[model samples]
Target: MTMELGLLKALLNKDFYEKNRGLRCPPEIFSKDVRKIKDCLDLAMEKYKADLTTEDLQAVFHATNKTMTTATKVSYDDLFRKMQSTKAIHGEIAEDALSSLFQQYVGEQVAQMGFSFVNGEEESLEPLRRLLDDYKNDFTPSIRVDWDDISIETLMAANKQESQWKFNIPSLRKKIEGVSGGHLIMVGARPNTGKTSFHASLIAGPDGFAHQGAKCIVLCNEESYERVGARYLSAATNMTMDEVHSNVSLAAERYDTVKQNVRIKDSTNKNLSWVEAVVKHEKPDIVILDMGDKFSSKTSDKTDVYLKDASIYARNIAKQYKCAVIWMSQLSAAAEGKVFLDQSMMEGSKTGKAAESDLMVLISKNPQVEGADEQDTQRHLNIAKNKLKGGWHGVLHCDLDGDRSLYTS
Candidate 1:
C-alpha cells in the first residue's frame, strides 16, 4: 500500500502529527497496530511540549514494538524516511487508489455483463448507473440504523435516563418531558422580551439542566462574554448585576461553581460548522445557541434557504452528539403587541418554524403593552409546538427579575 501503517505511526509520533492535523489516516492501513500506535501517539502528544525529543520518540517506539510479537521492530531512521516519502506522495496516492478502484469496479461489471451494446441504450447505461449509485453510497457517510432486538429491561432503563432530562420551567416540565437527547428546542420572542434571560435561567437556574449536573455549553453571538458571565452569575447567586459587581468575592465564588458544569463561548461570527466542531470536542449534554439568526449559513443561498439549512444542521448536530440543542430566535414585527405567538410569527424563515425544531416556545411579556415595567413584567411561556405529544399545548407564567436577569416560575 502507498499509505502504510508505519507511515501513519511515524507521522503521529511528534512534530508530524501537529503539522499533518488535516491528514486522513485510512483505518485499513493499521490492521494490527492501530490501537497501540494511537495510544502511544496520544501519550507522546500529552507528555511532550511541541516536538517529540529523541527519548520521547524512542519510548513510544519501544512501547509499540513491545506490544507486537510477529511484527519486526521499526527503526527510527526507517520510520522517518517512510514519513518523508509518504508526505511527498500522499495526495497522489489517494487519487490513484480511488481511480484504480473505480476502474476495477467497471472492469468487473463489464466482465459480468458483456459490454457489446449500443451507446445510451438502457442495457449499456445500466452498469454506469449502478456504478454511480454505489459510489454515492460509499462516499456518503450516515448514521447506521441498527436492526436489533431490544429487551423490555433495556427499554425501561433508557426510559429512566430520558425522564431525567427535563425543561427547567415547572409548567413546561410537567406538560412535556425535558429537552431529551437529539431534540431541538427553539425559543422565539419579540425584541426585549427577555429571551436571553430565559435561556440564561435554563443554564444557571436551580432547576436548570446545568444545575442538575448536565454539562452545558452556551454560544453567545450577540452578547459579550463579560455580559453573559455577569448574567449567569446573577442568576446563579440570586443577586443583581449591580450587587454581583459590588460583591466581587461572593460573585466569583458562585461563578467558580457554575463554571465547573457549564461553559460559555463567544461565538461571534461563528457558523454552524464551528458549533458542530465545538460539540464534537466538548461532548456536552446540552448546547444553547443564544440567537439562531446569528449563525452563518453554509451556502450562499437566500435568508430563508440559509435558515432552513442552518436549522437542519443544528438538528443533525444534536442527534449526532446525543445532546439537547436550545436555539433562540426572534419573532417578526407582526408578533409585536400580539398576546399569542405561533410558528408563523418566527422571523426570517418558516422552515425553522415548520420543520427543524422538536419543540417551539414563544415568549411574551404580560399585558403585551408598550413601556411595560421591567421589574414587574410577568413573562409568559407559550408552547406553540410540541412534537413529543401531539395536541399538547399550554402557557406557563413566570416572574421576570430584570435586575438579576432571571425568570422564575
Candidate 2:
C-alpha cells in the first residue's frame, strides 16, 4: 500500500508490456518480470501489517523495498512517493530505505537493446550500408560554380595556359605525374625502417610533395610529433644529423617550409576522428594515414565487422573529399613470402582495408644484398597495387639511402 510499492507495481506492469511487445522478448519475458515484482510487493504488504515498530517495520520495509526494487528496474522517486502516501513509511526511512535494488529480469530485458552485433550480421550490415549510402551523397555541389560553362575542352585549354601546364607537360612527356588534392599515399615498413623519414622526405625534401603543390599531413602514429618534425627538418634542410640538434634556427626554417606545403599531425592517441576532421576542414590533397596500427585499437580485433567498418570509413573519406586515402597496412605471413599480395596482411582489420584502398604499396626490406654496399640498397618499394589504375603492379622502386623523397632508378 506504500507509495513506493504502488509505483513499483505500475513500473513493472508498464515495463512488462514494453519488453514483451518486442521481436526478441516474448510472453514468458513479461510473466517473469510480473512474478518478480508481485512477489516483492506481497512480502512488503505482509511485513507492514504484522509490525508497526521501527525495527519490525524496518524488516518489512527492507523486504518489501527489496521486492519493489527488484520487481522492475524503475526509478526510486516515483516508487518512494507512492509508498509515502499509501504505506505511510514517510520521512527518512522511505528515503534511505531501498536505493540499491535492481532486478535481473529487468536487466536481462534491457541489455539486449545494447548488445552489439558480431561480424556481418544483418543488424550490423544494415547500418553500415546506410552509412555508406549517405557518404556517397553527402557532399553536394556548390551552387555558384559555373556548371553550365564547364567543359573538358575548356578545362584542358585553361590548364594549357595555367601553371598546371608544368604538372601536365611532364606527365604528357615523361609519364611522371604528381599527386595533388589532399591525396593519400601510404608508405609501409617494419619498425625503424625509415617510414617516418620517407614521409618527411616526401613533404620537405627539395623535390618532395611540397614542390608538387601537395600539403602532406603526416600522422606519426608511433613517434612523438616533435621527433617526426626533427627528422623531417633534418632531411629537408640538408643539415647534418648532429647539426639539426645544435642549430634550432635551421630546424625552425625547415618547420616553416614544411608548414607551407605539409601540415604535420600525430596520431599517438589511436583516435582517427581527428584525422577525419582535418580532412574535412583542411581538405589536404595528400593525407597519409602513416601505419594502419594507428587507426585506433577499437578496430584491432581483426574481425569482419572491424574490417568492413574501418575500410568503409577510409574509402568514404577519400571519395567524399575527392582525395586519395592511403592506408598503410601490414602484410600477412604470406605477404612476407611471394604470396603476400593477397589481402591478409593489413593487421587487426581484415583485407578489406587493403582491397578498398585507392592504392596499396608495400615497403619491404630488400633481402638481396649482404655485404658492404648492402646498407646503401636496404629497402625495396613495391607498388603492390594501384586500384584506381586497375590494381597494376609496377616495377620495383628502390630506396638505397632512404633519404630521398622518392625512389628512382
Candidate 3:
C-alpha cells in the first residue's frame, strides 16, 4: 500500500539486492514505520546470501524481535502484508529508482543546511562544501569486494583446491600439504646442487605436476632452452641422455604422456613485465622462472630494494593469474660445502626473496669425501619458511638421480 513497503519488496529481489545492498541502500532512507524491517532484511541477506521470500523476512524479524509489544506486533504484521502484495521492479529501472531515492535524501540534507544558513545558524559555505565533497564517490559504489567465507564450513573446504592439486613428492607432502593457486615456492641451491634437476624431477618426472594435469610453462634465463628441454626429456623418461638416444622410440612414447602439458621458452634478457605478458597470454596453471632474481633491473644501488620489488611482482603474478609459481634461485658461496642451509644463504640479497615467498625450500648438499670424484647426490631440503598446510619447518632427506634428472626418497 505504501511506497516504503514497495521499496522494501524491490530490495528483496536477488538481482537488485546483489547490486545495491551495501551503503547504497542504507536503512536511514526508510521511514520510522518500516525502518526496523529494513534492518532485519539487511542482516538476513548478509548471512544467507540468497533471494529471500516474504515469509523468510517475517520469520527472521519475529525470531530476532522477541521483545516487541502486542500493538507493535500487529502494526508490523500489517506492514508485512503490504510488502507481500507489492511486486518487485528489476534491472536498470530498479537501480535508477534507488539512485533517485538516495539523491532525494541527499537533497533533504542540503535543504536543511540552506535553512540553517538562512536563519544565521551557520556562518560560511564551508559546511556545504564539506558535505558535497564527502558524497562524491557514494553515487557509484566503485569498490567491488570479494568477501572471504568465514563460516565454519569453509575452514577445511577452503583448502580443497590444494588437496586436489596434490604434490607428487611423498616426503615433502607429509610435511606441508600441497600447493594450489596463489603459491610462490622459491627453490634455492648451490650451482651443482641439482638446482635444475630438482624442478625437472618435480615437474617432468613420472607422476609429477605435468602428469597431475597442470599446464606447465618453464621460462629459463639461466640455461639455454635446449639444455632445459633435454633435462625435461631425461626426467619424463627416467633415462640418461645416452639411454634416451639409444631407445628413442620408447622414450618418445613415455614423454608423449606429459608432452602436451610442458612448454619451455628461452626468456633471456627479459624482465618481469615480459614474463607477466607471457603469463597473461598463455594462462598456464603452473609457471617456473629458472633464475627468477635476474628479472629485475638494478634501479637503486641497494640490491635489497630491487630484489624485493622483483619478488613482489612475482607474488602478484601468482595471485592474479591463479597459478603456482616456482622460482629457481642459487645459494651463495657461504652455502658451499655445507650440509645445512637457511633463508640467509639465498644469493644476492639476504631476506628479500624469502620474505615474499609463501614457501622457501633451501636445498643443501652433503660434504664431499676426500678422494671421491663423484658429485654429491644426497640433499637436505630445509623448509625455512612455510605458510601452507601444516606450517612445518624442517629438513627432508632425498637423493637426486643426476643422470635421470629426478629426485627420489
Distance from true location, Cα of 309 in model 1, Å:
1.2
lDDT per residue as tens, model 1, 1-409: 3354434534544455553332122232243544344445556676664655434555676765675444345544455455445542334343344344445554565555554454423455676667567555343322335785589998777666654566676766778867677888899999888887887787787667777888889999987978887778788877887787789899877766667888888999999999999999999998989887788574755777778888888999998999988899989998887767788888988665458888888998755446755444778888888876434787878778866777777
**Candidates in descending lDDT order:** 3, 1, 2
lDDT of 3 by residue, 34-67 (tens): 8899999999988898888988999999999999
Off by over 4 Å in 2: 1-176, 182-186, 246-255, 296-301, 333-344, 368-376, 388-392, 402-409
Top candidate by TM-score: 3
Instruction: Put the candidates in TM-score order, highest first.
Output: 3, 1, 2
TM-score of each: 0.65, 0.51, 0.67
RMSD of each: 15.5, 17.4, 10.2
List, residue by residue over 235-321, the lDDT tens digit for candidate 2. 677665677668878767765765677666777665567778888898776677766545743654546567557667766776678
Error of 2 at 110 (Å): 29
